[model samples]
Target: MAKILMITGDFVEDYENMVPFQALLAMGHQVDAVCPGKGKNDSIATCIHDFEGHQTYTEKRGHNFTLNAEFDQVAASEYDALYLPGGRAPEYLRLDNKVLAIIKAFAASNKPIAAVCHGAQLLTAANVIEGKKISAYPACAPEVRQAGGEYVDLQMDEAITDGKFVTAPAWPAHPALLRQLVALL
Candidate 1:
């Protein structure tokens, strides 16, 4: 099993992230829930209650918890894959130099990097999407294209994998995206 690192922000799509996180654990991979620090407080708050609305979200609760490690604290060499869930968090995360560095490190390492919806924003910010074909929420297409990625308009059931990168549209695509990510593991 691969050692996976799941990165999030203050408020990611609560359900979309949990499914893949749980699937990785069920597949016997060791997963770490990493997030950026807002301040001195080490605990990262997530809308746990809101996440329960989805069936897949409920199953992923076992390993659901926060890690104190800021983006800069994460070591790229320790993880086999990086997973990003889409939401407003990506917009904020993209501005942090540390997060961008981590993103770039994962891309440089050629490790499996999975992103969904707005999470693609961070990928674009890291400048690693150049010449790559990926999928994201329709509203984010222009940004992806501007970043040099070919954005595909597809159903959530469809999973898009290009090289070491994998992407999906939104919450509905969680299952397919998780399955594809597990296959990579």
Candidate 2:
């Protein structure tokens, strides 16, 4: 079974973090979810981002997501793949040098990386998207472009796979993202 590392932080999208974690586990993969400044068993707050016919998605408080691993103890080489859950958390996690370094290590090893929604922000910040094609939330297209990446805008349920990288627009694309990730693994 593949050992997958999932990185998330406070305000991570509820479905993005939980669904994939459980889904991968069900597939016989071992998934370790971690967050910066958090230790094993520590929890992070989640937010539900729902599309309610408004101009933008609305946020609501969601369940507490517990971390099964410690971020500081993670070594990119120990994991076969990396998962980045999307939400407001990505906005800040992308700014962490340690987070960026972990991402770079994964990329350097040619390990698969799957990111959804704002999670693509980390790819941009790590400078690892250059010349790659990715699909992310529409709002993040500009960042992808600025990073020298071609952003393929997709609907909520769609995903794009380019080499070792797979990305989707949001939580709605979990099914597609997970499928592609499984194939890569």
Which is the leading candidate under lDDT? 2
> What are the models' TM-scores?
0.84, 0.98
Tell me how far the alpha carbon of residue 87 in candidate 2 is from the true structure, in angstroms, after superposition.
Answer: 0.7
Cα displacement (angstroms), candidate 1, residue 58, comes to 21
Q: What is the lDDT of residue 96 in candidate 2?
A: 91
| C-alpha lDDT of candidate 1 relative to the true structure | 0.79
Pairs with backbone N, CA or C atoms under 3 Å apart (clashes), candidate 1 = none
Report lDDT per candidate: 0.79, 0.95
Please state the error at residue 138 of candidate 2 in Å.
Answer: 0.4
Candidate 2 ranges with C-alpha deviation above 4 Å: none
* Per-residue lDDT over 9-115 for candidate 1, one digit per residue giving the tens place of the 0 to 100 score: 67666666677777777889887777776432354444432245665432222223455344556898899999988866789989988888888999999999999
Task: State the weakest 10-residue window (summed lDDT) of model 1.
Answer: 56-65
Give candidate 1 regions above 4 Å deviation: 38-65, 68-72
Alpha-carbon shift of residue 23 in model 1 (angstroms) = 2.0
